[model samples]
Target: MGAMASRGFDHIDTWVFDLDNTLYPAHHDLWQQIDMRMKGYISALLGIAPEDAFVIQKDYYRRYGTSLRGLMIEHGIDADAFLDHVHDVDLSTLDQEPRLAQMIDALPGRKLVYTNGSERHARNVLARLGMEGQFDAVHDIVAGAFHPKPTAEAYQRFLASHEVNAGRAAMFEDLARNLEVPHELGMVTVLVTAPGEGEAVRESWELEGREARYVDHVTTDLTAFLEQLHLQR
Candidate 1:
């Protein structure tokens, strides 16, 4: 069954997933809390009004791969300080969960986190989900590593460092653009759909002129998706 099933899919030996929206449901409104903190940081750093800073931060995040990266090149911003400032979120509102952890423990391949977020951000999310020990690897946004996702350069570097066989690895992410490179690289791509509270961000999921097929699968919830995947296909 393992051999035939493996062949049925694209020989999935490595499964890499995104951390943020892909790991937790949007209905939790965790991102909203985090966003406010990030905006606040931006305002304080640039000495601008909070509202104006939100626009500036988003603009830089869009124009460049990450706001910190843009800030690094343009303003000589301190990367560590920026990450510390932006990620200051209260996780007390979040409770530890074991639902997804079991599913991940059952998956039959090497698992890794390939995210543009820092290690601290990933750690917080994983711990909250009771999945702190699941992944075999976690990549962070630091020190000229890989270009970070949504860009070809970062994807290329990610695969290279992991020694990933694209034919055998699966890449899961919430961002459409980030998965596009993995799809083209022959990695199976899974898009985690927004559960709730993200209707306003729907347009952000679409990649312009992305025709035919780029995603192998899509799910509205992470743990639900993993539960199904664990079953015999």
Candidate 2:
């Protein structure tokens, strides 16, 4: 680690992580399930073709930060039902990541999972990863009043609810766009990337501008990054 990365980690007392690809490797294709589900949900809700729904889904994601948020605003769809349907993904492929769990457990201070997903989904993912009880809390989309990450309001709500001081906090996320707000709030931001291009599951838009100034660090291997922090401490 460079001196800047080391210094950034030194002041962190609250570690916030994005649950999906950030916790588990993107190669697992878990988000692909959710992506398809979202398209299906939109198609059914809007009485549109799957192809058309795909366009609308990506549009809403870009405009509102989440497809759920877009549906709620544009069509007034039931957020709870939408979340349940989209997050009903099979986790059989996600094996227990004991090494990753141990690294997370060794991190100092309060740890949290802050996701655009539902709390139930976050918990389920954590359980599957063998990281149950490793976090202080799971702040989900509902907790932010349906506002998703990358939005200042959502992050503000998370900070207040968790009593976290942004100046002493660090956030880890796979989507670089989601880290902009946290970085602006004075938290150190880490972008978790896929191990290789062939393993990437995120959309191009999600990975755009990943090298932006808001990102303090970028690591393809989150376990190794956390282990490096442990060694530094």
Winning candidate number (TM-score): 2
lDDT of 2 by residue, 1-233 (tens): 22244336887889999998889988887899999999999898889999999999999999999999998999999899999999999999999989989998888899999999999999999999999979999999999999998889999999999999999999999888988888888999898887664424556787686879888888888888888788878
Model 2, which residues run further than 4 Å from truth? 1-7, 198-200
> Model 1 over residues 44-143: C-alpha lDDT tens digits?
8789999998888777777777777777777887788877776777666665658877777777778989878788888887887788899988877862
How does candidate 1 fare on TM-score? 0.87
TM-score of 2: 0.95
Among all windows of 10 consecutive residues in model 2, the one with the lowest summed lDDT is: 1-10
Identify the leading candidate in terms of lDDT. 2
Per-residue error for 226 in candidate 2, Å, reads: 0.7
